[model samples]
Target: MLKFFSEEIDFKLPFPQKTSKWIKTISESEGYNIISLNYIFCTDDYLLEINKQYLDHDYYTDIITFDNSEEEGKIESDIYVSVDRVKENAETFGADFEVEMRRVLIHGLLHLMDYTDTSEELKLQMRAKEDECLLLF
Candidate 1:
């Protein structure tokens, strides 16, 4: 199941049904099944607090994923996304807000699928995967 929530932000996700279906397709394509996934949208301050409290990193990030999958090929996670950061990123990158939002959404799922952006090469690969997944919408 895919669920959406908000913290310290008054926001409603656009196209919940379509986005959920697209996410399911992305996971199945990666050979994983969705057990449960929660997307929490929040402000930069809220996410920063979560970063400090949970990750011990005092910084603002676009997304922070907490993986809870217990078995291989299954996915369970709590994905926290900073709506403030996404809006800023969209303006910085000259991209549409909805497009950038979807990118960030799938980026979290990609992490659950074992994709990383720790290196330049891997970052490129991850971006490519994100683009591919975006095209499915």
Candidate 2:
């Protein structure tokens, strides 16, 4: 199952059913199944508070993923996305909001799939994976 929600924001994901299918396609292509994935959209402040409270970090990020996948080849997690940050990143990257938002959205699922970007090399790999997923999106 896949769901979308908002926290301290008024946002709607366009074509949610299509989004769910796209996510499922990515998961299956990578040899996994979706149990439940929730996308919670929020303002920067709300997400910042969550980051500080849960992660003990004092910096803002576009997305925060909570990995709750308890079984092998399954996905069960909550993905928090900062709308403000997404908009800013879109402008910075010279891409439209929809494109950037999709990138961030899949970025979370990629994390749950064991993709890491803690180093430059890994970041490149992550980006490549993201691009590959974007083509399916």
Candidate 3:
């Protein structure tokens, strides 16, 4: 299952049929099955507070993923995304809001799939994967 929630924001994403199809397609392509997922969309202020509290970053970011996957290779967790950051990044990346939002969503799921971008090389790889996934849209 996949769901979306909006907090401190008033926006609606694409319909669940398209969203679910995209998510499931990506998961299957990545060799994983998404048993469940929860996506929370919030403002920058809300996400910043979460970042400071849980990650101790004290900074702003587009998305933060909380993994609730019980086993080493399972899909079950909550994904938090900031609409404020997504809008800003979309402009910066020269893409529309919908496109950028999808990128962030994929990014969070990729993290759950054990993909990381802690380094330049890894970031490049992650970006490649993101681009590849975007082709499905």
Q: For this target, which candidate reaches the highest TM-score against the unseen true structure?
A: 1
lDDT of 3 by residue, 7-105 (tens): 999978876579778988889887888888999999999999999999999999999999999876569988889999999999998998888999999
What is candidate 3's CA lDDT for residue 92? 90
Show model 1 residue runs off by greater than 4 Å: none
lDDT measured at residue 99 in model 1 versus the true structure, 0 to 100: 97
* Candidate with maximal lDDT: 1
**Which pairs clash inside model 3?**
none
Cα-based lDDT for every prediction: 0.97, 0.94, 0.91
Per-candidate TM-scores read 0.98, 0.98, 0.95
Candidate 3's TM-score reads 0.95
What tens digits encode model 2's per-residue C-alpha lDDT throughout 1-137?
89999999999988788888999999988888999999999999999999999999999999999999999899999999999999999999899899899999999999988899999999999999999988887
* Rank ordering of all candidates by TM-score, starting from the highest: 1, 2, 3
Q: Which model is ahead, 2 or 3, in terms of lDDT? A: 2
